[model samples]
Target: MVEEQEKRRSSEDEIDLIELTRSIWAGRLFIAKVTSVFIIIGLIIAFTSPVEYEATCKLLPESQEAQMPSLGGLAGLAGLAGVDLSSMGGSSGVMTPQLYPEIVNSLPFILEVMNDTIYFERQDIHATSFNYFKNIVKPSVMGYILKYTIGLPGLIFSNKPEDIISTKDDLSFYRISKEDWRLIESFKERIILEIDSETGIVEVMVEMPDPYAAAQIAKKIELMVTGAVVEYKTGKSLKNLEFILEAHDESKRKYESVQYQLARSTDRNRNVNSATAQIELKKLEYEFNLAYEVYKGLSSQVEQAKIKLKEETPVFTVLEPVRIPGDKSKPKRAVILIVLMVMGCMIGTIILFCKFILVGKRGRSF
Candidate 1:
């Protein structure tokens, strides 16, 4: 009896599926009209959207070994001569690949990048990034609509006179008004940077309304990032170099003065034959020798500090240089059309099913 009941239930299920299919087939014309309307709307959206061009570049950071120079031999020799040379040796700090993203996202670095001048091909003019974003670049049709509609509340709350006046008075480097912050946020969205941890490769992409502008910004950002990295890595070494240079100058002056004194004393005492004069000559000679050795050691340290600074400066090799993209990166019309059409079909099918169910319920009531 159970097997017979199961067979009957399966038959009823198959019948329902057939009825659903027949109902959909009968409503094919309605579905087609809905799809056609969606297609037209999709075409309008695709053509009216703002066009964007993308440019990308890849960089490989040169890895450096942070080994300090071996000063054991020199230290041993200096020790025998009763001079200390241990304070001159130092190791440079290493910057890892992970910090590249942080450096790029830093406020100061971003501000510097925005301050760069770039040429816009569409307008045939040169302008800084801040000016271009603020005054030159116009909003798209959809952007204007949404700004007044969904974003209207934010605009109302953010535009107080006190807020603007306070930000304007602050002349600090990091202080920015709401409008400037909006521009910065927009600019940040256009530029993307990523670093691969294992290979130490960096990829940067920039998107803009003009192809030339996109490529130009990409190249500029690449150079800025490299400069920032070099400056950070060599900061300590540069300071050390400066200090060594100052010490070196002072040591040379002292050594020269002592040598002069020794020379004058020898000339004055050439005719004297007293034990006191001889002892005084020996003391002056010893002072001059000690000054000469200190000067020599400082001179060596100056050279080493310069070499270390050069070594710490990192080199970035461009694997893929930025190029002007020939095609627009957005407004994929074909994809938009297909997705809209599929959505229309689903909506039409649901409507037809609802209608069929309501009619069947009325027939059962009768």
Candidate 2:
């Protein structure tokens, strides 16, 4: 009796599945209409979307070990002994690759990038990045729609002050307006920087509507970051060089004075055989030699300091150079269409099921 009841329940389940399938087949026309509407919407979105091009460049910071190969073996041994020898040989403090991303994202760095001149191929104009983004780049169709509808309040009641202090007038402080802050946010979105800590490699990516502009901005950012890094790493070394140069100049002057005194004393005492004259001549010669040695030592220190400054300055090797992208990076129309169509089908099925359930309940009530 149990087996017979189980068979009956299984048969009913199959019948229910068949009925649901037939219901869907009968309402195919309704589903098609929903899907068609979605497809049209998708087409509008895909077409109206702004195309963007991305340019990327990879940079590898020259390692401290690579810069000083002679010290590499010693450094390794010292590491085993729990001592760091990487800072030896007049090398300045290390600026790790991990800090590079922070450097690129910094406000000052972004402002520098914004002030750089970029050539827009489409517009056939050269302008500062700030001006191009603010004035030249126009809003998209949806952007305008949203601005008028959702963002209309902000426009009407904008709190932007008219008499804002300019950076040029107040060099010590930076005061930015609301619009400028929005522009800066947009710039942060366009510029992307990534770093690999293990390998100390940095990748900079910039996306812009214009391909040439994207490439140009990417290259400019790369150079700017390199310059910043070099400046940070060599700051101490430069100061050392300057101090050594001053000492070298002072020593040189003293050496010259002593040499002149020694020459005068020797010439005056040439005819005298007196002990006092001989003693005076010896003292002047000794003074001259002492001054000469000090001067020579400072001169060597000056050369060494200059060399150290050069060595401490970082070098960035471009693993992948920036190039104008041939194809757009966004607006995947096919994917968009497929997604919209699937959403439409799901919505149509839900509506049909709800209607069918309501009708069945009303029939049973009757």
- The top-ranked prediction according to TM-score is 2
Model 2, backbone clash pairs (residues 3+ apart or across chains), number: 0
**Candidate 1 residue pairs in clash (backbone atoms < 3 Å):** none
TM values, all candidates: 0.82, 0.82
- lDDT, model 1: 0.82
Q: What is the C-alpha lDDT profile of model 1 across 1-366, one tens digit per residue? A: 999999998997788779889989999999999888888888877887888999999999877642233445555655675544545444456677787778777777777778888888989999888888788888777778888999898888875333322323556435567777888888888888988878878999999888999999899889988888888888888998999999999999999999999999999999999999999999999999999999998987776676667666787899999999999998888999999999888888899999888987797799
List the candidate 1 regions with Cα displacement exceeding 4 Å. 1-5, 66-92, 160-173, 272-283, 354-366
| lDDT values for all models | 0.82, 0.84
> Model 2, stretches more than 4 Å misplaced?
1-17, 70-92, 163-165, 168-172, 197-199, 273-283, 354-366
Clashes of each: 0, 0
Q: In candidate 2, residue 183 scores what lDDT?
A: 84
In candidate 2 the C-alpha lDDT for residue 114 amounts to 89
